[model samples]
Target: MTKNFNDLVADLSEIEGGYAGHVPPEWLQGRTAYGGLSAGLALAAAQKAMPDLPPLRSAQVAFVGPIAGDIRIAVDPIRRGRTASFIGSDISFEKDGEWPMGLRTTFVCMGERESSIDHVSHDYPDVPPPDIGKATSRGQALSFLQHFEFADIKGNPNQGPADYLRWIRVAERDGLDPMVELMLIGDALPPAAMKLVEGFGPISSITWIANVLTTTPETDDGWWLLRSRSDYARHGASSQVMSVWNTRGEQVLTGMQGVALFL
Candidate 1:
């Protein structure tokens, strides 16, 4: 069945032990579901497990195996403290009954805590607005790309400093929970390894670590600025840094991903 971004997130429902959901093939990168979908669902399950929990402080996800078809997600609380709670989540494809993907995150509901320092030293990059660029067309190249839109802001990656900037958003309007939004957009960028080569190639993310600065920011127009750069790529492995900024140029989430470059 065809499902939009909201539909996809809506399908995730809290069950007795955890959550249950399905991702349509339209969002599949290959035989496996899109990395963001799996991660987002896991985070959603985490949210359900701790509905009154605090905002996400840090989250690490390891893609143990392909998560596709129907699936069951279970969340476990590692530890709960007054100010912070650590959570662990796991997902298993229902068809096979073998759990693979796993996520661990720390949430903090900082109330009126006294802090000696508060500062943001980083600055947002200057880039053209999303409307000024053309919508990226993967052209049935990958069924997954159809659900979202992209505007390429930089040219060939191999010819430059191996940095990529783009504007991305879902085609359909969907109200996503805060944690769910962070997980989905954090993995939206095409692997930075693609810039290390002459053209497109196969790449799979083995591990992803996202540090959410705050509750997911509300998107005024649903557009997010995706900026990514690869720090190193060697021996069939690449490490890249990525960030998702809202339309107002605020850094909502930052992450690092380790990918297996098949090229």
Candidate 2:
């Protein structure tokens, strides 16, 4: 049976070193699972290993290989400082009699302290609000997409600038940690290069770096603005600048992703 994000998360069992979990095929993208789910699971394992750790400030994730079926996430606390803690988590599983690493993540969790300076470097995209009554759709018929709701804003790439803008939210968001929630929805959009390609092709995210702008990232009615801009695309690879904002027009998270495109 297919399981939602919350249900899957609740099934994670704590092992000796980390957490053990399973990913159903309904959440798989091709041979692997969704990028957001892997990254979110790594973060979730890290949180479970150290419950008192501070809020997640930033995360650096490397997608090494395909991860499906039963998985083991080993968490290692690299260091703990007065206000910040650094932890490393690795997701791996045995397949075909060989253990292949699926994902490796380094999390920087820090507590907020008074700073002498504060500034805003970006603003929310000037897009219309997400219509809750409108129907949601997905660009591709990937199996994992059914877990989330996408209200895409149609546009023409020839107008002025080109980008993928949409409002996305999890279909099952009850009782989710704020940090875990961000990880789940942050990488929900496909590579911005998908619009630039003519026909459909396989694509995978190689690396992703996310910075948490605020500890308490909240939006109205679970709707968050998602924008992905591919500034460079060439030579079978592409890079995108990703951002997520709340309904109150607050910038919550900023991310950069490197995708390996097989055009």
Which candidate has the highest lDDT of all? 2
TM-score of 2: 0.94
RMSD of each: 3.0, 2.0
Query: For residues 1-263, what per-residue lDDT tens digits would candidate 2 score against the true structure?
Result: 76888887789998988988998888898899899999999998888888999999999999999999999899999999998899999999769877689999999999789999999986566666677766565534448888888887766343224378889988878888989999999999888988886767999999999999997888877778888889998999999999999888888999899999887
Spell out the clash pairs found in candidate 1. Answer: none
Taking all chains together, each candidate's TM-score versus the true structure is 0.86, 0.94
The window of 10 residues in a row where model 1 has the poorest summed lDDT is 102-111
Model 1 superposed RMSD (Cα): 3.0
> Can you tell me which runs of candidate 2 are displaced by over 4 Å?
138-142, 156-162
